[model samples]
Every structure is written in C-alpha cells, then in structure tokens.
Target chain A: MRDPGNSGHPDQSGHGQRGSIEALQEHVDALEHQSKTTKRAHQEAMRRERQLRTHNAVLAQLSMNALREGCDEHVARREIVTAAADALNVSRVGIWLFGDDGQTLRAVELFDRQGGFARCQTVIRADRYPRYFEALRENRTLPAHDVHRDSRTKELLHDYLEPCGITSMLDAPVRIGGKLVGVICHEHIGPQREWTLDEQTFAGSMGDFVSLSLQMGKRNEMEAAIKRQREYLRQIIDISPNLVFVLDEETRFVLANKALCDLVSVPHQELIGNSAMNLIKDQEQARRLRKMDEAILRQSQLSIDCEESFTDRDGKQRWFHLIKRPITSVDGSGKQVLGVASDVTERKLYQEHLASMVRELDHRVKNNLFAVMIMAEHTAMGSNDIDEYLHAFNGRMRSMAIGHEILAKTNWQGAMLVEVINSLIRPYVGENLRHVTLDGPDVMLPARVAPAMCMMIHELITNAMQHGALSLEEGRVDVLWKVEDQTLHMNWIEHGTQDVAQFPQRGFGMELIERTAAHQLRGDAQLSFEPPGLRCELNIPLKLPADRHE
Target chain B: MRMAINAQLKDKLKDLRVLVVEDEFLAAKSLETSLRKMGCEVVGPASTVDEALAFIKSRTIDAAILDINLSPGTSEPVARALRYRNCPFVFITGYSNISVLPDDLRGCLILTKPTDPVSLAAAVGQLAEHART
Candidate 1:
C-alpha cells in the first residue's frame, strides 16, 4: 500500500526502484516459505496425533477384549495381531512365542494385509538367527528400518525379508513376569520404510498386551489347579472316620470336615468361623479344651494326645481320643490347631469291661488260693497220713477245677445243675455210669453257688466210693432232683451197702459239705443212714438275697 | 501241727472275743480255727454285712476281722458300722489294691488274702492292742 514517490532511492529512480522491488520480492518469498513449512509441520503433528489416537483406541479395545471372560489365548492372540497390523498400517503383523527351550520362535498367528489372517507356522531357531535372538535378549524394541542392511535383520534378508517382500522390520520382545518370553514382529513391504517412534512404542505395547493375556491364562490355570487340590483334600477329610477340624488362633473354627460337623450337630458351612468352645455341650469340658488349645498356641506344648469326654446335645456322654497339633495357617499368617478325634465311646466301654474282668479274675485267683489253703489244712487235720491227705485233697481240688471249667464255659455267668451233678459223679461212676442214675431238670446255678454245690456232690460220691454202694461192683445209686419254689430238692439213694448201714460218725468231709451248703448257699443239707445205704437231701435257694449279690 | 502263733501278740488275743466276717465258708472256718487256736473266743463268722452288723450290735465284739468283699458289695457298711461303734477292725481282702475303700475306711489296716494263720493272729492282735490303747 506504500507509494513509490516516498522512496528514499528516488534520485536513482528507475535503478533504485527495481532493486527495491527485488528485495521486497525476496522478503515475501521467505515469509511464504516459513508459512508453508509451519503448515506442513502442523499437518504432520496432527497426523501423528491421529495415529496415536488410533493406536491407543485399538490397544484399549484389544485389552478389553482380552479381559473378557471366555476369550481364550488363541482368540486374544489373533485379535492383538490383527489390531496391531491395522493400527500400524503394516504389511504383516505376527505373534511369535519362544519355546520352553528358548532356542526356537514359533509364529502363533500372522496377519497379512493382503492375504488376511493365517499362521506362518514358521519356526526360526536362535542358533540360525543369532543376531535376531541377541537383539531380542535386550528386552527392548528393535526398529530395523532397513531389513536387508540392518545387522539385526540381515541374517533374515534371504530367508525371510526376500521371501515375504519385506523391506523393513520392527520387533518388540514380549516379557511375562519380567522375563523375555516371545516377540511381536511388524513387517513392511515395498521400499524400505522408517519406523516412527510412535510405531515402535505401539509395538512395545502390543508385546505387553500379549504378556498380560498369557499371564492371565497362567493365573487361571493355577487357580483351577489350586481349587482341585483343595477339593481333593476336602474329600479326604470328609471320608475319614475321624473328626477333623482346624481352628484359628482365636479358637474359632477355620475348617471343619463332615465328621466333625456331624459330631457337633451342625453343618460344615455353619460350623466354620464359629467358636470351637460352643461345640462342647459342657462348660467344664469346653474350658479344659480351651486351656489345652491355648497351650498349643503358646507353643508350650507341641501336641496333645488325650482322652476327652463331653456330654452331647442329646445329653449322652461321648468320649474321644483327641490328638491336636499346632500348625501354621495356610496363609502362613498365624498359629492354628489341627485336631483329629476318634469316637472312642465303645472302645472305652470295652476297655473298662476288660479291666473289670481282669480284676474279677484276680479276685477269683486269690479266693481260690485261699480255698486251697483251707482244704490243705482241713485235709491234713482229717487224714492219718500223707497218702490220705493227698488223695482227699486232690479229689477236692479236682472237684473245684471241674466247677471252674463249667463256669468258664459260660463266661462265669452260671452253670447248669445237671452239669454240676454229672461232672462230680462221673469220676466215681466211671465204667458203671449207668449204675449211678442222675435225674434232674436243668437249673442254671449261679457262679457263686457252683463251687459249693460241687463240693457237696463230691463228698457224697467219695463216701459212696469208700464204704457205700460204690464199694460193691453191682452197686447202684439213684440221684433225683427237682426245683420247687426256687428251692433245689435232691435225694441220693444207694442200694449196695445195706450191711454198712450203721451211721458212721460225722467226718470232716460230711461236716464241711453240710457247713458249706448251710452257710454259703443259704440252704440246708441232711444225711441219714437207711437200710439201703445213705440218703441225703438238699434245699438251696436259687437266688441269693438281693443285698447279698456281688 | 498247729501253725506258729505270734509270740508277742498271743496274750492280747487270749480270750479276746473276736468277730469274724467272711463270705467263703472254708476261709471262714480256717479263720475260726486260727482265732480259736490263738486262745480267742471267736464270734459269728458272719457271711454278709447284715450278719456282721447284727453280730456287732448284739455280740460283745472286742476286736474284729473283716473280709472287705462279701459278694455283691464291699464290706464298707460293716467297716463304717465298726468304726461308729469305735470297734478296732482289720480288713482282709483278696484284692491287692484297697483304693476301693471309702474315704473313712482308707486309713484302716489292710491285709491281703491267703493270710497265714500266724499273720492272721498277729493282725487281729495288733487291732486288739490298738483298741486297748
């Protein structure tokens, strides 16, 4: 808009004006060049911003897809490679996984812009492509702008780049758990292409996405394995006959198996996290258990094997042989108690029974020893010589032994009256058993009464053998017995010793038999000499007086 | 031959009216013979707690020899009865362990079974001597 007349160079008018115009033209050209450069730079920046946006959007979508449940490894890998190839505008994009040996890289999925998705199924060995592997070992992205000239990809010039018509390559190492596991490769075709920093960064992020998905897959597999292991252990404890439970440091139930739950009359789910003290129906027992548990937790005791008794919900007493051990909790956070209890109620009863039986046997042995002592003393008193004493004492002992045998057969419950009578008389009647007739109903004589009755019967047989009917070959005897009003009535008649009918003075044997029957059996025994031989009758109460029973 | 009697306790047992409580008849007879040989007037060889208790109530029992186990139950009632009467008594039992006795009777004298006549006489003599003092 300035006028040419205001020019300082008016003196050299024409020449000066041309020079001035030239200078103005040069200034305009310089300004225009600066404007054009600024516009182009702004356009380049906008394009990069758009590319970054696209890359970020693609990565974001791929991450969300990978996170979706039921998106398997193969599906996630294909999505990642396709997204990378599309976002980066590359000819090919592939996911390569390093074998466990770390020597071979296998192409899992390759996305070809021209050919669509396919598996290159190419396995490249680290030994054959040493420089490529060495670069991957750096755990950083490698941007080989010229695939043929770049030393990192030069080894792949003939075999890979030429075959795939790739002029450039950008590879990013995939790391899982901070260890290099594989790589993501971006291959470009046509003329050599320079990889932008944004593209290299995008490649790195893709590797990260692959690592994350694979890490998630590994975690899922581990979680499933852990669940299976927990189930296996649960089944083991549930099937066990023993009551198993785990308690935390607070004495609350951390874990309880089916057996323990059933014992407490609670369900497995309901019992967990509940105080173990509540399971014991008795306060005193629970207190004692708490003390024991405390001791275990304090490490004052390593474990306890004790007999525990408690009243159950049904008010019935139950016994357990409980073994408890202090254990570190599964999370290794604090102390816990592992308890295994076996229901020993029946076993305890059996043990008590066995103890009582042993005591009873001891009592019987001592009592029998005392009885033997008395017999020896009495036999010595009544006999004139050693032979007489031995014979008589041996007979008495044999009678007692036979009685014991009968009692043993019945587990010391009782013996039948007929068996007792037959056993005593069989020794004397031997071959002439028919001559000594025994007639009686079967009566179960109590254990306490059997020995006394045996003694009486033995005395009668001895007398008959010595001087009564048994002294003669053709002698015969009739033994008949019956029970009436809980009283045992018996008559022993002899036929052959009539001439010896004169009543002999009462001997030690007769007195002992009579006294035993009268005192112990709480009964009476009478002996009379008749024309035939000897006649005896006994009346014994079947049951002892109530207070007198042992 | 008579089993030797304790020379030192023979006089204390002499003419002593001793009550014998035993269930086994033979053992009772043996105890009776031993007491009689010791120059003691033996009372009823009562076979049960009631029999012994009755004798304790009726008879002039200066000292007693009691079998701890009668049949169905222990001789705890008899021991208590004798204790109530301030009667000195010695326990004879086939059981080696006497922890079965009640608290009051645990302090009483105990003698295991198959006691020789001499020992039996001595135990009774000791009970009589303790009573005299």
Candidate 2:
C-alpha cells in the first residue's frame, strides 16, 4: 500500500522516500523474477511431457515391429537388439542367453548405434564374477551411472570398462514362463550417463520382449521339427507293400496304403472314408470280417495276426492276415485304430485244395483196394495151382503198381493215354520197349480211367503170354489207337503168328474186355475172330463215363 | 485114401442139383468142379446179368449160388428170378460188408468168394434138406 503520489523510482524520493521506493522497486523486481521463473518451469515441464510421448510412440512401434511375423522369433530377437539401442539412444546393446548349465552367459546378439546387429562373442563367467552375478540374479535392473565403481558391475572395470571406455550400463533380466533365460545390456560410452527412470523402464520392457521372442522361437522350432517327423513317417508308410491303414470307430477307413486300395479294387482317393462292409461282396464272409473288427474295437489293445477271408466283386476269394492296434491321443479323447495286413489268398486257397485232394486220394485208394481184393480172388480161381496164381497175380500187381507210379509222379491229376499203355507194358516188354508198340495221338486220361485201362492192358498182356503175340519169340502185338469222330478206336493186332488157332469159346479175357469197355469206359469191344491170333478193337468214348467212379 | 475121400465128398450132396451163376469165367469153372465133386448136377454158369436171368427162367434149378455184381449190372435181377421160382440161393460177392448189398438180398447168406468150401457145402446141404422136406 504505497501512496498513489509517490514515484516508484528511488531517485525521485528524498532519503526515506527514496528508501521506501527502492524497497518497492525491489519487491516489484522480485515478483517479476518469480513470475519468469514460474513460466520457465512450466515450459520445461511441457517439453518433458512431449519428449516422453515421443518415446512411448517409438517403443510401441518397436514392439509391433518385433512381432511382425510368426516363426520369426530369432528375427524378432535381432529386432529387439536394434530397437533397444535406438530407443535408449545407446552406443551399444547386447543380449546374453544363459546356457543350459546356467553358469555361463553367452552373448546371442549385439547392436551398435553406429553398426547394425551382428553375431556376438561376449561371454560372462558367473563363477569369476561372483558378486556381480549374484547382484544381477537378485535385482531386475542394474542401472549404473559409474559402471566401474558400482559393486554390482565393478568386475568389468579393468577388462571391459577401461578398454571400451564404457562408463555406464543398464541391464534387465529376461524371464520366460517364470524362468530367467537371459539378460539385455544397454551400454553407454565416453561419459558416465545417469539413467533416468524412463530409460530404466524402457530397458526392462526390452527384457520382456526378448524373453517372449526366445520362447516364440523355441515353439516355432518344435513345430517345424514335428512337421518334418510326421512327413517322414507318412512317406515310409505309403511306400510299404504291406496294407497299412487307420480307422475310426465307425469302421470307416481313415488312412490306407496303396496295397489296400488296390486289393479292394478302388482308387486311393475313393477308398478313404469307405466302410469295410462295402468292400466285401459275400454276405457270409462279410459278416465274419465285421465280427473280427468289432472284437478288436471292443478290446482296447492289440489284436495281432488274425486271418480273415472275403470274396471280392469278381467272385474270387480274397484272404488277409490282419493285425490291429488301438491308438489313442495323449488326452485319451480321440480313438484311432492302426492296422497292418498281408494278402494270404493264394496260400489259403492252396491249403483248401490240398485238403480236397487228400480226401479224393483216400476215396480212390479204398476203391482201388476193393478192386485188387476181387481181382486177387478171381485170379486165384482162374489159377490151376499156386504157381499159376503167383505168376498171374504178380503180372497184374506189377501193371497196377506201375500205373500208380506214373499217376503219383503226375500228382494224381491224370496220366497220358500213351503213357498209361506204356507203363502197363513196361514190365512185359523186353529191354527196348519196342516189342509192344503203343501208338496214338498223345492223350491224357483222368485218374479214374487209368485203373480201368490198366486192368485191360493187364488182361491183354496175360493173353499175349498165354495165347497171343508174346507167346512166340517172333510174334509181336501192335496196339494202334486213333481219336476219330470223338471216339478212341484202338486195334490190338497180333503179328507173325504161325498158328491161326481160333478160340474154342469166349474166355475170361473176352468177357472182361466187354465188361470194362461197356461199363467203365462206356465203349464197345469187338472180337473180329480174324484169328490166326487175337484181333480186338475197342471203340472207347474220348470223354470218361459220367459215373465211372462206381 | 484120396479116392475114398473124393467118394465121401461126392456123396455129401448126392442127387443134389445146383446152379452156379458167376460172372468170372475162372470162378464159374472152379465152382462147377466144386459142385460136381459134391455129387450135385451143375446148371448154367452164366457170366452176365442177362445170362443168369435167362438160365433161371428156362431151367428147373434146385439151389442157386449168385455173384452179387456180375459186370455190366448187379445180381439183383438174377436174385428176383431165383425168388420167383421159390429157389433158395446163397450170394458170393467181393463186398465184405452185408449193408452194401441190394435191399432185397440184404439178409441173404452172402459169402465172399472164392467161395469157402465148408460154408458153400453147408449152405447147399441145408437147401437140399429143405427141398426134401
């Protein structure tokens, strides 16, 4: 409250007035100074606010850039190093990852403000720098203005600090899934730089970014490895000749090899997702196949080496030896069945055919034995003495045995018609087989025909020995047969016979020839009676009698 | 001694007339001799099914011996012919099992031949005695 008339200048007032005016001027100056100081402080605070907003924007952009692409975890790591240096405005920045042992810290990446990121070789030994390592293990960030003097970092004084002229460092631990994996280092050069709270926080954020990128990188690596392993297994299964397959509970095919597809006569793409029931055309066999699969599904383990058979669309029997194992997901949520199968159709059919053949052999042997017993008894009756019986029985038995030998050699399928004639005459013929000539177009006769023909040949040879060709040294019997008009016309001609003796009566040979021809061979037998010696002609049908077995 | 035994053997079927119906020629010849030695008059030794049936139809047979399967057919028709004449006969077959015979001749005294001499004589002697009664 100064007087309104009083001048505000000290020179305009007397001593007291002057002193009061000076005091007032001093107060005014002090107030003006205070006002300017307040305005400057306000401006300083506004500039700092603008700077902090710029840093936030830059860091946010850096973070987004670091996570730009998936499976780019390592790429993101390199980005983190470069971005950290740029964001903090530091000369050098490095990331160190702890090895598995956790004692040695090897630098993974390094970035210079002047140079881009490069592979690093910086390693810190935890054992050698005990205090420093311990301090870092306990604290999250170690911001040092004087790195060489800080107890948490003094181990770098002589070797790292003096050499590179680094006066300050800010480090933050990068943790992933609650495990400390690595550390990010912000190193300042030349002057010892005092780290502000903003710079410290930024460094800590970079640590978080590093740990995330590393975890992401490991995940990407694991996924790629899994993908590669799955492909290898798929290739192995596809190329294998074994019918490899997978199925769901519905009996639908989930996956099958080319072998399975080809066996079912369907293309690979069309075969998948098809039911097993659709592949089998036979209802009886299809039911059996379904029973086996249902049993496997019911037993939640493995069903190994079971044989299954079914008929295909072509009316051919198909056989498989199958093995199935149930596979479940780790969580036990999904059910899949793995199957390996072998095609055993040929083996199974061969066994069945062999069994039928064995039965046929049994029936044939029994009938043949019956015929032999009758033959032996009748031949005995024909015999005047035991010597006659032995001689005739031996000859008949020899012919029968030789016929069986030829048949056995041919697996009982049939004997050649000429071979049958030759086999019976083999024992009777002298060394060369030329005495008894068997002539015909080579025809094969079934097993049933062989025995009847053998008995006929036996009777003829017996007659030849007694009354016909071979009775004389010079006489020869020529057996010539021809297939004419679907009939076997065989003529037995006795040659070089000096005595043209006619038969006194129709004997056993004639009667037997007639019986065998008419009943067994379904043919006609004629004794021409041109006899100087016997001339018998047999007109046998080319095909066997329908019920010849009886 | 041999002459005495043959005489005794001949007298066993003295005045007996027997028919031999066998298909096998040698078997018929052997059987004819066997019947003759027993002092029985031999009838036709037919070698076929028709021959056997014809002999039975034409002749007055005392007792008959029939082979079951005379080739070209079974001895069924021959058996029917013998039965029509009220003739008692025995069957000689290669089949040992009696079940395999025709239903008409299932229980007929069937013997597996070459005929057992004792059985053939006994059967014929019994038939001869039955004829006398």
Candidate 3:
C-alpha cells in the first residue's frame, strides 16, 4: 500500500540542523514547514470525511427512493454517478456494470461534472488491460495519482488517460453476491490529484447503490420475457377450432374456449366450474369419459384418443373424438386435464352409409343373377340347336348388361325407362339416335325391373330390324306408352319391312315377352301381324315388384 | 280343369262390382282380368291417393283388393274408405312381413304376392259370399 503521509518525499537536506547558526535557523524553518504541512493534511482529511459522509447519505436516499417508487434503474444509476462526482470534485464519474457473462464492464451511467452530462455510454475490456484487471482484484481503489506513471493504470497512459488529460483515477470495485461485478470510476483531469482515503471509501459506497439498480433491471427483464411467453401460449390455445378445456381434479371445467362453451349450450360464465358429465345425457358415455380421464391422471400418461356420443341442443345425437392429456406444473401447483375434442358425427354417418351401400349392392347382384337364370331357361327351351341357343343367350346377356350399366351409374337407385330403351337401341341405332322413335311418358323404373324391360325391348327391335320396319333405311319404329289405371300399355309398331307369314315355331323372343308379361308384370300380351309390320302391345306394371325393397 | 272350375266360380261372382287399388299397372290389369273372369265389374285400379280418392267418391263398390305399398304413399286411406263404405278388402304384397300392414288392419286377410291362385280365389270367394249377405 502506498502511504499518503510519505508522498512528495520529505526534504533530505533538512536533516543538517546540528552545525551553524544559519543551519540552526533553517532547522527552525524546517520545523515550521513540517507543522504547516501536517495541519493542511489534517484539515484535508477532515474535509474529505465530511464529503464522504454527505455522499453516503445521498446514496442511501437514492436507493430508498428507487425501492419506494420503483423507478427506472438507469435513472437511479445516474443519480449515483452524479453524487460520486460531486463528492470527489472530479471532472467525471461513471458507474460501469459487468455484463451477464462478466468478461467486460459496460459504462451504464457517466456524469461529466463540468458539462453536467448524465450518461455517456462506454465499454471497457478486462482482457486488454491485464494489470488494471489484476489490480482491481487486489485493491479497494487504485488511488492512481499521475495515472501515466502508475503500474496498473500506465496501460491506459497513451490510449485513454493521457489523451483525455486525465491525470488521476480513484476506482473502487462494486461487488454483488460476493463477486466483483463492476466499479465506480472517478477521473480527475488538468492536474494530478492524489486520492485521499475518505474519497476512496466514498466511491465504494456509490458502487453499492449501482449494484442494487442492476439487480432490479435484471428482474424486470426476466418478468417481461415470461409474460410474453404466456401470452403467446394463450393465443395459440384460444384460436384452436377444437373444444379445448382444462379440467380440475373433480372433472369440473376450470377453463374453456368457444368450442367447449357451444358444446354445453351455455355461456362461458355458466360453463366454468360445471361438471361435463352433467351436460351429456348418455350415462354410458359419461362413465367412459370419466374412466378415460382417470387413465390419463393415474397412469401419468401423455394423452389418449377416444370417441363418445352426446345429445346436442338440437336434440340430435352428435359424435365427438377427444384427445386429452394431463398437464402438471413442476412446482406441483395442481394437476389439470387438457382436452381437445372434434366433431366426428359426419364421419360416423358416412361409415355406416358405406356399409349399407355394400349390402344393397349385394342384394342387387343376387336379384339380377336370378333373373339371368330364368332368362337362360326360357332361351334354352326355345333354341333348336346349340349355335342358336348360344346366339340367343349371348344377345339376351348383352341386353341385360347394357341395362345394368345404366342403373349402376345411378348407384343402383334406378334408371329412367327412356334411358334403358336408348341404351338397348344404341347398338342398332348406330350414329343417329333419331332412327328409332321413342315416345313415352317419363318413367323412373326400379333397378330390378330395368333388365327385364331391356330384354323385351331388345327382342322387338332385333326382330324389327331383321324382318320388320327398322330393317330398311327409310323405316322407323314408333314406341308409345302411358300410365293408365297403373297399367303401362306400351305399343311397339314396326313401320316398314318385308311381308311374310307368321313362323310355325314360336321363338324365344316371343316366349320371353309373353312369359315376362305374365309372371313379372302379371299383365296380358298381344302380338298382331299387320301388313306394314308386327305390332306387339303389352300392358305391364309401372311399379317395382312386391319383392323388391324400395 | 282349373279353368273350368274358375268359370264355375265366376258364376257365383256374377254381377258383383269390385274396386282394385294397385300401384303396379300390370299387376292391376292381371287382377282386373281375374275379377272380370269371375263376372265382377271392375271400378278402378288406382295408382295414387288422388286417383283412389276420386274413384271412391264416384263409385259404389261391393269389394276391393289393395296393394299395401303404393307409389306416393301406402294404401291406408283406401282401406279407410272401403271400411266406411262397409266394403270388405284384402291386402297383397310379396313381402312376407305382416308388420307392413297398419295396426288396425293386422287382422285383415293379406295375400303374399306370387300368391297361390287357390288362396286368392278362396279369399275373393269368401269376400263375395260375405258381400251377398
């Protein structure tokens, strides 16, 4: 430690007071000079102590004001630097705080006494000034007189102190939580000033005030960060379309969104603290939801997916798929059930309809197969040769196939009678559909009836083209029908063809027509041979068979 | 032999008037032909509510046969009309399920279509015998 008392070296020639009268007179003068220096030193000490006491009181008051008003930390730090600069009568004083990592000091509040500047932001690196860094660790203050000549501060001689005309520095380390966190720097410019013991102590008190401000600033930043995160998380939850809710230990809703509120058919105020089981009428569903909740909480599992049904406000049953999980705070505040439920009623209905569609398709296939069997039997009975039988069977199959193609396109709902007629004649009509005149009232025929009617129409047209009106280019067929007394009286008249006597043998076409009328339609048939062509008029049913399901 | 017997049955049904309410045109005509062969004059084979209601308003029917499931709706109104007129009727359907009939008509004679010709003849003969009385 450098002694302040021994500074400015005692005069070495003042010790020869033992010999001459002039020497003796110089000795008396030396004694007076020593006494005057001692008195001046004593008075300076007393003045510094008074200044140190005032600085401490001001620092204490500033800290108290900061705590009471909760003002900005930088404002409190500025007040501290101003008080320090006044106490030392220094040109400038600054409070430098360590960064979070503590590798450097940030000059947070700098006050220039002459200019009265409150804050001048600056940075100091400990790595570049090893001697000052080491000195700060070892001493309360450098008391750096003639800063260019001091061992610790000479590192800043040309770069900082000398350039700025700063001849002296009184620096005191500011410690927080038992580590050196920062410093209070007092700079004297124009002339070198030896730092008194009281000035060094006063600088240390100002450093304490800055440490308090730093703690408050850090806390405020942390709180602000946490609040932002919470707001972000809450927004994400509120915007979700699913029924998001938090349930208490008793399964009462403690928090809910619009979706869950709409589910219970209640306003948010009424929904809170209400048990979900009370809203669902189904006892089994309530029990299942309760059990699932237990699984989540008791098993300490993350989440579970489940489906449940409940009656809606509209009195229709609605299905919901729930994915719920348990959430717990690390501090063990309480356990909560965080659940998200989506409406899956339409999905369930589609699945059931898909299954029924498959069943209906099965029934349709079976019914058509039975009709094919009956048609084959009649065709086989009428054929005289194998080739003839095959030809007749193939023709009948093609007619049925064409009929089903139209029905299946409509999902087996049914085909229009007109559509069935057109499909069967397309092969014979070629490019122009106008060749065959189809005139009839629109009839929505059942899927079961299309194939039979298709076959009957097929036979008439084939016979007409081969031996009747449709055989000639100019010839045309006019078909007409109407619903009268529930009987569809369809007339198939061929206009032009070669005249011939009736065949002796009744072909399958004739037999199929007469049988279908008698058995399926339960109607009578008439075949008349006029000169122009044959007229086959049959009165058939306009309704689905009693055996067919609607 | 069945034709000869059916003609003989027609002697009993001669001069009787009957109404048929069937949706299927061919089934209606086939029933009409049977009723005609039995010497019963047929009034109508109504396919819908409006047609059947019209026939009921105009005609004085002795008996009727009703198809249970008809287009536009079931034949309940026709059965109600026949009941108000004191005309005995029977229902016909290919469906074996008797549940399709209304609660009041559960006891009514219902013929399963593609029915045995003998049963149909038997039911009509019985209805004719009751009508004469």
Candidate 4:
C-alpha cells in the first residue's frame, strides 16, 4: 500500500509547479502593460507644462509692449486677449468688465485667431448667461470639461460657441483690491479639450495684468481733468479788466491777479504775503478795509462804494472804487475775501471842476445884476422927463440881458469875442454895420469884460444914431481891436456928422464908458471929438485879476 | 420938501435906536442919511466881523438892518445875536440872490439895494409893527 501512494504524489507535485510558473509569468506581463501606460501619461503632462510656460512668457512680453506704447485700458485688454489666445492655441479670446452698475458684465475686448479682432460688443446680455455670471460674481474660474453636460451653460455655449466651432472654454476673474473687476477667457474651436491647471494659471496672470492697466488709465485721466480746470481758472483771472485780489482770513494778500498787480503798480510776487493795508496810503481807508475784512471773516456779505487812495510802487497816489465780496466754503464754515477795484480818480476831479465852475458863474451873475441896478438908477437920475428915463432904462436893460444870454451859453466862463460882437451888432448890423466897419482878432473875453464892452458898444452906437455916422446916411463908424504884445487895443472911430457939435458936455453914457474901461479894468481910454464925430480908443491887458475885471 | 421936514423933525424917532451892519463906505453913508431922515438914531455901520460883534454887544439896539454878505464872508454873527436878543432886522443886499441868508433870518424882510425912499420907509415901518407885536 505505501509503494502505490508515492507514485501518485510525484505526478501531482510536477503539475502544481508548472501551474505556479505560468501564473507568475501572466502577472509580470500585466504589470509591464500598466508601466507603459503610466510613462505615456507623464510625458503628455510634461509637454503641456512646457507649452504653458511658453504661453506665459509670450503673454508677459505682450503686456510689457502694450504698457510701453502707452495703450489705454481698452487697447491693453485687446492685446492681452490676443496673446493669451495664441499661447493657449485657441481660436477666440475675450475680456468682459463689470460696468458702473455692478450687476452687468460688459465685453471690452474680442480677438479671433484667423481674422482681425472685432470691437467688443456693448451688449453681452449678462442675464442670458446665468452660469457665467455666477462664476464672475463668485470670483471663481469656471473651466468647462463638457459644454453639453451643464444645462445652465449648455444654451449659452451651444448658441455662442457651436456656430464658432468652439468646444472648451477657460474663464478667470480679474481682481483689484480684493474686488472682481472683470474676467479674461480663452475658447478652443478645433477639438473638445479639458483645461489643464497650467492654462488656468496663465489666464489668472492675464487677469492681473488687465487690472493694473485699468487702474493706471483711470489715474491719468483724473490728473488731466484737474490740470485743465486749473488752467481755465488762471486764464479768467489774467484777462479780466477789473482788479481782482484774494485775501486770507488774516487779511494778508494770498493771490493777486495780473490786473490787480498792474493797478497797484506792484509785482504779483511782491503782493503775495503782504498785508493788504500796505498798499493803502490813507490810514482811514485802511481802517475801513480792516473792518470789511472782519465782516468777511464773520461770513457776512458786504457791498459798499469805498473810496480808497493807494500809493503805488512809484509812490504816486491813485484813487480807486473798491467792491469787496466774501467767498465762503461750501458749508459756509470758512471765508476768504475777494475784492474788485476800479479807478475813479478822473471822474472825481471832473466833478470838482464842474462845481467850481458853477460857483464862479453864480458870482458873475450877481455882479451883473448889481451893475444893472446902478445903471438904472443913474439913467433915471439923468433924464428930466419920465418917458426919456424909461426909454433909456429899457434900452440898457436889453443890452445887459443880451450879455446874460451869452454868459449862460458859455457856463459863465466867458464869451467868444466874435459871438459877443455879432450878437451886439445883429440888431444894428443893417442900420449901423452896413455903414460902419467892424474888425477884430478872434479872441475869448472873460465874462466880466463882456458886460462893460457891451454897454460901451451900445452907447457908441446910440450916439452915432443921434449925431454921428448914423445921423448921416453916408456916414460910417469903424470899430477894431488887436492883440499886440498881449495887450488888447480897441478902437472906435466915427467918420461922419461934419456939421455936428464939436463936443457935447460929458454925459452919463460917456461917464459910464470911461469909468468901466479905465477905473474898473485898470486900463486907459482916449476920447477925441474930431470934425467928423467922436473917436474913442481903449487899451487893456488880456488877463485881469478877478476883482478888477469882475 | 416933505423929506427935509422929516429930517428936521427927527425927534419923532429919536428914541428908535437901530443897528446898521454894512461893509461898504458909500452904501453905509447913504443908509445912515436915509435912517436919520426917517428920525432914527443909527447905532453903527460896522465894517467887519469883530467890529459888528463888538458894536452889537455894546449897543442897546431896538432894530437892525444887516448886509447879508460882508467882505470876508456872511453876517451870520449879527443874525445870531439879533435872534438871541429877540430883535427884528431886515436884510439888505445889492443883488436878489439871497442863498447866503441865514436859516433863522429867512422869514425876515429882504430889501434890495439902491432902494427907493418908499421901500426903505415901508421896510422900517414893518419893523415897528413887529416891535409892537
């Protein structure tokens, strides 16, 4: 029984050894197949890593170039989108930014690999792309592995990407100061692909580059706006005609416009930091200005016609009419005084001159009235008959009245000699000047001399009417005057009335003419009774003292 | 003449004392004769501010006739005194321009110069009326 069992065991042992060797060979073959699969996957990952590194380098170069060219945010965004698309080997790239109203995402840049880039459409219609909008609001990257799987993204991807042949998409949010400003995305149109971690990281870097460009662009725009506003204000201040000045709360000159500097004859630099009162020559005016400044400090508006006299840089006194106003801060908590001044020196002087003229005119009129009264009394005393006295008085008054009319026309300074002579001789020109000869230099006589000359001329004419040139139709009276060495020589000659008396007794008319021409004027007169008639000549200086002449 | 008889019988207005403030010599002399003929005693015909003021203080004046404008300026002093003493006075001026007339004396009688005997007599008569009142 022992010999038969041993022979069965040897065959079983040999079969079991052969089975174990075959199973080990099968296990080794399976492990070799898995090793080949793992090596292929690792090589594919390394190839993707190198591609991403190259894409990142290209993106960095594009960003640096865009910045050096001073590209604005829109241009910089477009450049970054195109570079990212080329690096990722994609067909389209786009950048969408949050609008002022934070709920919407507006497309800012769009690039296509085959054709030129198109301007970003203003209407991305964020409401229609719910999944994409949620991704942006959450500030998370959304890489779609299969566009057809997610129902929320399927409609947008199918409608927007299917026609363009796009299958995969990668989107990353651009953050600034921990806030999502926009998103950068790349779309692949050739084949359905999954986004690797490297592609996502590159997209994130692009988002960062866009955020920096936008911030810089906004800062530049703000600075330019501020500069333009300052230049406009400076132009207005320089070209204004009225003097403009700004004073601090301490009453010191903070700024003076060009007009104000020219007005005060001081340089703008000299005026700044100086006490405003230093320009004022009059102490009283300075005190008033200080009070006005105090009022401004209290935030009260003041308007006054202030007469200020200033000593200019040349030490010349100039008068100005100052109008001060207060400029208050927006909240009315602080105030600065603004003053505008206009020169009124000439106007004030003209007013003074006019007033003095009026005073002098009044005095002349009173003196003339006195002369009229005296003449009336003397004429009345001279005549025996009432009719003769009345006639003489009326005639003299008429002549005096004519003088008044002339004085009135000239504001009582004087009358033109030609005007006075013409007025006096107008009534008698046909009757007397036709036969009489009148000649004189063109001269202006003072108001005082006019009355006396008028009276004398009347008396001479009356005498000729009664007994000289006017007495005979062929008779003539020659009157002339000349300015010789500043002396006025007046001649009255009568060359008629041969049969008239050689000389009549001195009468009131003769007395008046003599007294007025000689005593009053401090001049000399000669009266001769020639065979023809009576001749008279008078000589006087051109300028006379007021009392002597008046 | 009636004027001569009036001048001789000066006793009627001998006690009627009057103050005369005038600047001109000729005008003042004529006024003095006219007043004397009307039988009034002339207190003075002062020529200046000081003289007029001194005469006003020294005299017992019943009435006064003042020239509105003296040589230097106006007769404001005489007007003020006459107003203080409650005395009546008439203003005499050569011209009708009386802008310089004192505010207090605006209501007083104004006599134009080279006045006739009748006007002088009437102005004096009015002063007598004021005195009686």
Candidate 3: tens digits of C-alpha lDDT, residues A5-42: 33442463344323344765887899999999999999
At residue A135, candidate 3 shows an lDDT of 87
- What tens-digit string does per-residue lDDT give for candidate 2 at A335-443? 6677898878889889988876665565456545645665676677678899989998888778778788887888766788787776677666646665677777887
Which candidate's DockQ is highest? 1
All candidates: DockQ: 0.52, 0.06, 0.06, 0.05
> lDDT ranking from best to worst?
1, 3, 2, 4
lDDT of 2 by residue, B54-124 (tens): 77778778788887765446677877877877888888875554565766677887777545566667777
Q: Model 1: per-residue lDDT, tens digit, A250-341?
A: 89999999988776689877888899987766688788899999999988999999998877768888899999999999999888999999
What residue runs in model 4 are displaced by over 4 Å at the alpha carbon?
Answer: A1-122, A140-155, A158-241, A255-258, A266-275, A300-305, A311-319, A329-333, A342-354, A410-414, A429-432, A446-448, A499-502, A518-523, A543-550, B1-133
* Residue-by-residue lDDT tens digits, candidate 4, A251-282: 88877889888877788889998988887767
Give the TM-score comparing model 2 with the true structure, all chains together. 0.69
In every candidate, how many clashes are there?
3, 1, 4, 0
> Which residue pairs in model 4 clash with each other?
none
> Which should have the higher TM-score, number 1 or number 3?
1
Q: For each candidate, what is the lDDT?
A: 0.85, 0.74, 0.74, 0.72
lDDT of 3 by residue, B38-79 (tens): 667888777665677898889877778887866446888889
